[model samples]
Target: MDLMFLRATLLFILGVYANSLAVAKFIATSGRHKVKVICFSKTGERAAPFIRQAAKDYFSEASFAYVLWREIDMAFWWNMFGVDSAPSVVFLKDIYSKPITYSGSFNHLQLVKMMDDYKKNDIPQLRLVSSMELGCDARGYSRSGNETVTWYCLILVGRAGHAMTQMRETLRRASDVLMVGDDSDYARNVNLSVAIVASAAMKENRLTFTWLDGEVQQKYCQFHLAPEYHTKSCGPSYEDGVDAPQILIVRYLRNLTDDNAKNDRWKHFRNQYLGDTKVASQLIARYPGPEDVEELIQWISHIVERGDTREFPYFTFETPDLVPEDKQSMGSPVGQSFSRGINNRLKKLHMYISDLPRDPRVGPSLLLAACLLFGTIWLQNNRTKQANNTPGDLASSTSSRGRARARPARTDDVPPSMTDEEPKDAYQWVTTDSDSE
Candidate 1:
């Protein structure tokens, strides 16, 4: 009984853990991506294969799910995403945005095109993971490599708005102009200063163009942007009632002088104090100018020409890490998904166990429950043992009483004098005629 109770308690805990894990998984996937494509099908005849193939191509941009259709849940489909039938696809772009539903057959090319159109925005937002890759992070080296000591990052920082959109378009145009080279018609049409900057950027391959969400990354924006512009550029829009988009150019410089003595001294210092630190000293400069393509290009050109020739104040600080856009790219889709699920479950379990010590109610509550369970099991075992011996005890007592009652009692009234006269017995046998016959 005690062993059974222990097995039952373990099963109950496992059941709860499984239920909590499922809930955690649902929540983890909810905010994984801004876009989610779900295919509803009664038999998964065509949509399943199509969605699976599409997921492989656009795995980094959007998430996909396949749901089996049931007639009983027809109203739920319609009311939620207006998906009233099987063989339909619903694209949920955002939490508050309306869903886009389609119910027709589509070829692979058409599906890919549609996904491309919907999955990404006009300008990719700079995230923690992409910052280093794009050479926008101070601690990381340039995308061109360590040999390229100087690099520039052109960023448009602001909240979402028409102004921000227009600025992003201008930034995109500037990037395109640079990519087009000097002989292009667009380059010739541009001003001389813009052309010079574009030419220098193309020749060096040291410039990267990206955008930042000022509201989301307020600390980074505030740190880089001038104090006067913080009200108009960074933080929530409601605070200043202004969402003016601003462009900032960052220049990064690294020193690669080979001094063995200096290197050895620094190495010794790191070993003694820092202990395996990867932080390096680098100089950074921010552009303080209006948001104009011509001026921006000219500033970049000047920085490229004379940035290394001059000296600037060098500083080091920890920067915020960017969120990765392609977390599922490391392995096969199925393996990645399975590993992610296991990791999430283990992380949740760890968190739950870690919190138990901190929660004041958990310790005592668990102890009380354990004591109650043990007591119940002990009582059950005791009752079962007694019940098994009860019938044997009753049988033994009854047999002893029967034996006692079966014994005959001797009385004092009976005389034993006739036994002593044995001589008369020899002649007494003739008196009994029936006995003699």
Candidate 2:
């Protein structure tokens, strides 16, 4: 009889498990990105409390790891994922190569899921024949390749100082070389592929410079030569008037001071030309930064209003430069101080123009571009930090989250262990009126 009872219990357990699987199927087929599991233990480390709260707060898909053995696992992670201190939760993924994110000393998994919204995760894809723009949403690999090399010259002013080291890394990954210092001969001569740095501390306004004789600097752009006004130059003088492809790069010194000291001619120019425009006068029409639309005019000048050039790819999204830690510098006291640091960031549009390869598989370039597009420097920095830390671990973490939301929930199954028979001696199954009498 006991053997028979055991068999019956096993059958019941199997039935229950089958029902649970069916219910799970229904839920998966029904909701998308709605399923979540709460994995936690009640009497455990701080991990449990956070999971409970996260789940209670409508983190409907939230969960816990229960931290079965804090020390064993902690030790493993410290050696494994570099889990140094408390408040550490990781968001893992099913994919093999991805990022595992940590919220902080007090990091939580729930926070990572919310912050790294599934939709926002993307990598750049190369167009093959065209340019591959990985960095900015507005950027894509675009090269007409049709235009003549209209102009060419080594440009200047590179990152002479910066705020962070990762910033330095980001800069290096962005370019082919770091513009350490002056490339005077390259600047003076033309057609050497190129190497130059911008020394904002001592800008020569070579852009505004007239020939050594007295004629204004001009280019003989195709169909329109004998030009009149100062512009950039590369190969032939206007006398030759040959049109060729032109490349322009703006490098910056690490530290910044008044580029236009006390004289302030730009201010005067703006006051005269833009004074009456609504942009200059009204708060409703605020000013765009110098890199994009002018401080005022372009704002009021246009009939149709929208975003400024800064929002575009070829225009404004530029990051800060890095100053080297050591240097034997030249220039003013301010310039000398910034001499060491050199973090270089190029405008996305220019990168598209430069002959750099396009690989969606790469990280820094697109990551930097994505940061610019989403306009989330902090979040990007965090991603980069997580990236640098526990490289393999982080990637796994993201894959887990992606898979989590994909799994369906089974909300209607009977509890686990429902097949056991009742104990005859220990408990009564029912009450009888006759027995009571």
Q: Residues 130-249, candidate 1, lDDT per residue (tens digit)?
A: 566777876556777755777777788887666786787777666766666666676687665445654666556588888887876788888777788787888778853888877767
- What's the TM-score of each model vs. the native? 0.51, 0.18
Q: Which stretches of candidate 2 lie above 4 Å from their native place? A: 1-50, 53-64, 98-437
Supply candidate 2's per-residue lDDT for 290: 33
Q: How well does candidate 2 score on lDDT at residue 402?
A: 91
Q: Which stretches of candidate 1 lie above 4 Å from their native place?
A: 1-50, 56-60, 63-122, 202-204, 257-291, 321-437
State the C-alpha lDDT per candidate: 0.65, 0.30
Model 2 TM: 0.18
Q: Write the per-residue lDDT of candidate 2 for residues 286-351, one digit (tens) a residue.
A: 122232212111222221122111222222332222121122222443564333212111332243
lDDT of 1: 0.65
